[model samples]
Target: MVRRRLGDAGPGGRGAGRSGGGYDEAQAQAGAVLRGERKPTNPLTAGQVHVAFKCHNGKHIKAESNEELRASSSVIKEPEKFEVEHSGSESIYLKSHTGKYLTVDKNGDVHASGVSASDGSVFQVLLQENGLVALRSHCGFVAAEANGRIRANRSLIGSWELFQVKDRSRRSRTEHPGHELPEPDEQDDAPAFFDAFCQVEGILTAEERYAKTHHDRTAVLFDKRVRSRRRDHMEWSFKHFYMEKEYPPSFRGCVSAWDITRVEMDADGESDTPKAEDTEDAVRPRTRSGSDGSQVVSFDGLEAGRCHWKKILQEDLTDAVRIIAAFGVPAASAADADEAAWQRLLAAQAGCKQKTAHVLVMCSSGLCKAIGPIGVDCSPWPPALDAVFAERFAGLGAGSIRLKFGALPGEAYDVDKDPVFLAWKRAAGPTARGEDWVLQHADSRLAEFEAARSDYERRRLSEQVSTAKKQLEMAREHGLPVILQLPAQDDAERCMAELLVAVFGEASQHPILLSGFNGRPKCAAAFLRSFPGMMVGFNGLLTHSKHKQSLGEVAFDVPLDRFVLESLGPQYPPADSAAGSARGSYSHPAHVLLVAEELARVKQRLPRDILRAAFSNTAKLFNLSI
Candidate 1:
């Protein structure tokens, strides 16, 4: 038994430690203030207070005379001012200037009623970092605004639970009590601004913390700052290059390199015909009449550095009947004039009306020519060499374009000297046909590359599937979501298909996400056909020229469950283009930041459910502590 001291009840009535004592004292003070028996001891000089809450839909909490609190967007001419009386401890009792006290009911509805500081009328004032205050009812629910009404409902503190309390009586700076203002600092404010920006953009919530967690095991390692830098660089690049055309919808899924020369040619060809003098410094052609009344032009280079002759010959000569190409010209006195003459000759050939023209473009690699159809004939070279050339010329035109393969009379196919050629030949096999190269050999080589990539994916998925299956088998496994990330390749699909077949019946019942196969619609469709229930996603940046053939077919063809914009690490090769290389390599930090910024923008544009589910799945996979 504890003895009560006289000081415990002196003046204040009961001990401060007692539970009901604070409420009784607060109630007496509130009653005194309401009855004009005592002056309110609140620090804030209030006549009319404007309370703004940080709800999903930003609106102000307003109180009408003798009515419940509600959120409103309209401006109140005469707002109700509360006589804020300080209660014992960190609590307060707000009495409306109209002789009514703000009280909460059993249902959490707040209304202006009697002046007695009952448990409903007493509120704990919680201060937040953003200079906002939270009002918590004695019933352990935070006073929050939801759907245009003020109610005490939230158990955890969040942006929605906070309110900005301002004293209207001291609205003007001159009339307000003097106080020292904090010094302005740009560096300190940047993080706050960034956090607010991220919150508003839905990339992060107010309660979410940013931690430097490694995401290497995921599709790509994303850095928020790097993403911002990438966005800035792209915008600058677009403006600097004066590129005005909108991105073709087909190109959006894959990372690609654009030929500035081809873009210039298209632009020029669309508006005006390029003149002979326009290309006088680039190419020179000496023409002679053929036996069949056709023109045969032998193109020569005067200067080595005058133009990218290889690019022009490779890209522009697709429509030509045959190409005789050569490289490495000996230093000559009249190199500039000779190059100018060569450009004039090529320009003449470009404007020529002859259909069966045989053009020779010389380079360092000696003279090479294409015979037969205007499109590339892959029959000359090995299947592997043809595949390489096809990738190089992918951006040139439409249809099944093949590269001219095999060696001419002077040139021998040197598989011993070139390691790349040797590897290609080994992969293509002897039976591989060059005529159906793009369909057969190229696809086969792509399959081989996929196989190599999938080896690791297969191992990883095998372990993950085994683990997930075991976890599902464990007791109380309900609501536990599992996500498996597989490389966007056929082997991955094959491996997944095999593994999933065993657990197909069990997997269909649980929440499981299948990521990294969204780049190809056919692949995604295949997975969906097999599983019919698994959620699928893709890494948007992984699809390159090797996958370009199927890119257009998948563009807007199938609806994706998720779209993940992943960052190819700093060492990832730039897209195959002169302009892309000139832009310089991306740093690791810049890569991550750019990816994060892009992810945010993508989130804003994509469907809400897909993004939400993707993020949830990612968090589950990475166990992100943030």
Candidate 2:
């Protein structure tokens, strides 16, 4: 049986009586003293707040406000875990201020929200959304916890300069200059709220998806390897958009495994019927990602981990190593050299003294290949190079120097004992790659903001239509339907009502591709309202961790299978730029496989199905779960 042990305290001191004298009785006595039974003292060192009088009858009273008493506890509580319901536009403002855990109903004080009081304070939870869990300290996310910070991940903490490449020689031919890529063009007229963002993100994600589907073969072959080995050692290096996601410059998030599920439906291959016409096969149940390498597949059900992997790295290597070890996993290597370097790293971690605990150097096949070939004990990677480099530095009586490597691969192989290097050894997980991680959410007056944008869009669209119809000498196309397709995975429905306006749509008719917020000054809602009675939109799904993929992403409670169907309606897809035959399209396994593998590894290390559920809730609130 699973051992359910309470951590010292329970609600109102309910469980403590099991040990020794009743802790409840002691607390009642303490409460009496707190109430005013005993004599008052100056103050007791509880935490920060002062405790005054010690009354008789065991009541230990503290003269703090009733509010403080209501919230007081020895442990710190997280506010994000608190679930509030959104009945509608009317209910978002109606969140209960009582913050009570139970409601008086036919169920007899059943769970009001998912949150339950624990240890007088702390709230152990499963996430219900993706935004910052605003706390007294600052804003942060639970995903940051894996990186040695139990606290929240700070919002947009770093400046652009922090990402400057240190060495020019080590740069990849594809992205050596590290120049800025042009943000997608935004129309002067844009929509409001997430509507505009959805349009913009939809275009971008569609473009990227096109690259994957069309250019995948080319991207796989001649995939320029990002990191290289110099002479007898490894050279850890990278540049923007280098060979792949695992290269230090990757925009991927900090993902964990077990966050994606892989299913197998009946329609993966052609039917056995030899004479069947229109021989289209049925769709199969698979993981979120479609890889050329079929052997490394997993059927677990994690879907929202894509949000985690694409998250930035907060902690450095040393702390990262500690976190890996905490989960009983070994250190991940950049290349084969990491295997031998593991011993040196272990010794160094122990101050170069006799090593106590043994650590295994695990690396993915993608990463191993990056460091070139490997023998029984020799290679030219960071870990292997570090061992030699450390020795060289020590021999020269130089000061201690830290060896840094770029993004580490997501795979691992135990270079020590029983030889372990199987397919997807540590792969098979969900990931959140390709999305912005920082954005200041407009708070406090969100409702007002929504109202303002809607009004603005209405007036603007009315004028545009009035003027356009006069100029073209065309009659107002009354009762015409307008379609604004959000990215494929994005919920265009919520923002649909907001963007229904007649304008020069795609094909000059039918469904129009309303240019969403492509870094444009105008908002999406206002742009839509400018053209009153008209249906205009194109379909394209902005694929990413849904949260930071702009407002174009939609949310659904169902898995990827069901969520994808909504995008198939009348919508304009992104133009594929990487389309062609599968010849020169093939790239080396460098950035291509490395990225997928890294994404896979990162995905494999996270919590799966639960994360997706939380992601859905967030989508609903953001108006993306249409």
Per-candidate TM-scores read: 0.23, 0.16
> For candidate 1, what is the TM-score?
0.23
Alpha carbon lDDT of each predicted model: 0.35, 0.21
Tens-digit lDDT string for candidate 1 (1-626): 00112112233222234564343344464456556565433333233342223332323455665477665532222343455776756677777645677888887778877667777898887754434567788655554443467778678886557665534333544554596444323222111000000001111110111112233422132234323323443211212111222211111111111111111122122212223342333334333322122233323211111222334334331121112221111111011112333332233233233222222222222222110000001112223223644444322110001012111112222222222344455699997554453444555544433332233233332334343233233211223333344444444445445544555442353434453333344455444444444454333232345543343233223233433323222233223211113223221111222233223332323333333444443333222322
lDDT of 2 at 15: 24
- Candidate 1 error regions (>4 Å): 1-102, 111-119, 127-132, 143-150, 153-160, 170-393, 396-626
lDDT string for model 2 (1-626, tens) is: 00011111232222222555443344355456556566343111111121111111111111122211111111111221122332222111101123543222221211223243422222222211211112111122112121111222333322110110011012244664666443222111111111111211121122223333345653433222211111211112111222221222111211111111111111331112112121113111122221111222212111111222211112233311111110000111111112233332222223213423321111210111001000011112222123423333221100000000000122111121101111122343245221111122223123222333333233333333222222122111321212222222112222232222222331232322232222111123323333322222111322223211222211111122112111121122221111111233211112121122112222222223323332242233222322
Instruction: After superposing candidate 2 on the true structure, give the runs of residues whose Cα lies further than 4 Å from its correct spot.
Output: 1-296, 303-626
User: Against the true structure, candidate 1 has what lDDT?
Assistant: 0.35
Q: Give per-residue lDDT, candidate 2, residue 561.
A: 18
